[model samples]
Target: MLIAFNKPYGVLCQFTDESTGPARPTLATFIDVPGVYPAGRLDLDSEGLLLLTDDGRLQARIADPRYKAPKTYLVQVEGEPDEDALAALRRGVRLKDGMTLPAQVERIEAPDLWPRNPPVRFRKSVPDCWLKLILREGRNRQVRRMTAAVGHPTLRLVRWRIGDWTLEGIAPGEWREVPV
Candidate 1:
């Protein structure tokens, strides 16, 4: 079985919180399916679609960088990017880890998205814009890093699609099972 969960912001990707410290929300709060694990991680601050599966082979296909399954993000950035920045993202960007693979990137009008709780901060002086970025590789905080490297910091990040599956009708904090 495969599951697609629309993870809400501030929720940990893992099902358990091992630490005895202050509690933060986790996948357990939204998902109750047994024998399934997240295919790839979404950062605690990011809101988006997270795929889970009980089959190890399916998990590997989705999570392993070698498979190169595309993940698409709708990003709200702190500044409007020029053509140079867009081209740089399309070509590739040098990061602390290594050069990122070329990504499919384009400027987009703000997506009609559900309102985030507490919401992203607004700045009058600093203009913000939307970007659609598709990457085949998942790296730690990669999207945020790439945008910052191009002189535009990400204000909000949402993963809309993974492989052929998408958030679609799934609302935040909800999960739906699909056939593998």
Candidate 2:
């Protein structure tokens, strides 16, 4: 079985959280399907499409970086990105780990998305803009780091697409069975 889940912010990618702090939300809170596991991870702070599958081979294909499955995000970033900044992102930005694979990035109008709980901060002086970023690599906080490297820190990150699947009809905290 394959599932496309719209993961909400503040929800852990795993089924459980072992930390000693106050109880935190996790996949288990939303997904109750037995034997299904997340194919790839979406950070606790990031929101959007997360795939889960019961088939190991299918999960590997979706999650493995070697497959280069394209993941698309609509990012809200601080400051307006100039052409140079966009070019840098398109050409690949150097991060602490290494230079990332060149990404497909473009300035886009703010997407119509569900409101984030607690909401992204609003600044009166600093200009902000939206970017459509498509990447083939999945490194820890890569999008946030890349934008920061280009002098535009990400304010909000939302995964809109992964490979052939999308968050089209999935609402936040909702999941649906999809064909593999």
Candidate 3:
């Protein structure tokens, strides 16, 4: 079974009671169908589409770095970006680990999208804008770190697409089973 779940912000990726305390829910509660695991992950603070599957091989294909699947995000940054900053993101920025591969970065206006439950901070002087970043990597906090490195700190990070899958119209915490 291939389940495309719209993971809510602040929820752990796995079906682990170990990490989540009393109130926190895992994939176990949402997906009653057994033998499935998440293909990759959405950080606790991130809200987006997550693919889950019962077939281990299919899961590997989606999640594995060797496959080079492009994951796209709508990132809210702290300022009205200058072209230079966008260029740096396109060229690639160096982090503590190393330099990231070049990404497809574009500036966009914030849409009339659904508001996050606990909305991001408001800095009146610092206007925010959206960025579409498509990358073939899954490094820890990569998008957030990269934006900050380019001098535009990230305010919100939402993964809208992963390879051919997308969050689309699926509401937070909803899931749909699609074919392989």
Candidate 4:
């Protein structure tokens, strides 16, 4: 079975016993079904669609770098992205690991977004806007780092879609099982 979970902000993706950190609940507490693990991770600071499955192969197909599934995000940044910054993102910025694959990105209006708890720091001096970023690879804090690499720093990040799956219908912290 395949599951699409709407993970809320500040939730851990894994079911680890790492008590050292603030005990944020993970998928294990909510989705009790055995033999399944998350396909990929949405960091504790971000919120949105997460896929889980009982089959390792199915999970890998979605998470692994080889398949290059499109993952879309709604990013709110500190300043307007200049043409050159957009070009850098399009061309793929060089990271410590290597250059990220080019991304499809465009600015968009803030679409009646739900407010996040313990909201992002407000910067009245610097203006902010929303951008839709679609990348085909999974990297740690890649979206945030990418935006920061350019002048515009990411103030808020939310995953809206991963391939055909989405955050639609599901509320924060909800999960449902579907056939593979």
Candidate 4 matches the true fold with a TM-score of 0.94
> Per the 3 Å backbone cut-off, how many clashing residue pairs does candidate 4 have?
0
Which residue pairs show backbone clashes in model 2?
A: none
Residue-level lDDT tens digits of model 3 in 1-180: 899998877788889768444767777767777788999988878888899998999999999989999999999999877999999889989999999989999988785567887889897887889999999988899999999998888888888888888888888888999778
Off by over 4 Å in 4: none
Model 2 misplaced stretches (Cα beyond 4 Å): none
- Candidate 1, residue 171: Cα displacement in angstroms equals 0.6
Better of 2 and 3 by lDDT: 2
Q: Each prediction's TM-score against the native?
A: 0.98, 0.99, 0.94, 0.94
lDDT per residue as tens, model 4, 150-179: 878888898989898887777778887765
Judged by whole-model lDDT over C-alpha atoms, candidate 4 comes out at 0.88
| lDDT score, candidate 3 | 0.87
Per residue, candidate 1 scores C-alpha lDDT tens digits across 50-164 of 9999999999999999999999999999989999999999999999999999999999999999999869998899999999999999999999999999999999999999988
Model 2 CA lDDT for position 116: 99
* Winner by lDDT: 2
lDDT of 1: 0.94
In angstroms, give how far residue 19 of model 2 lies from its true place: 0.7
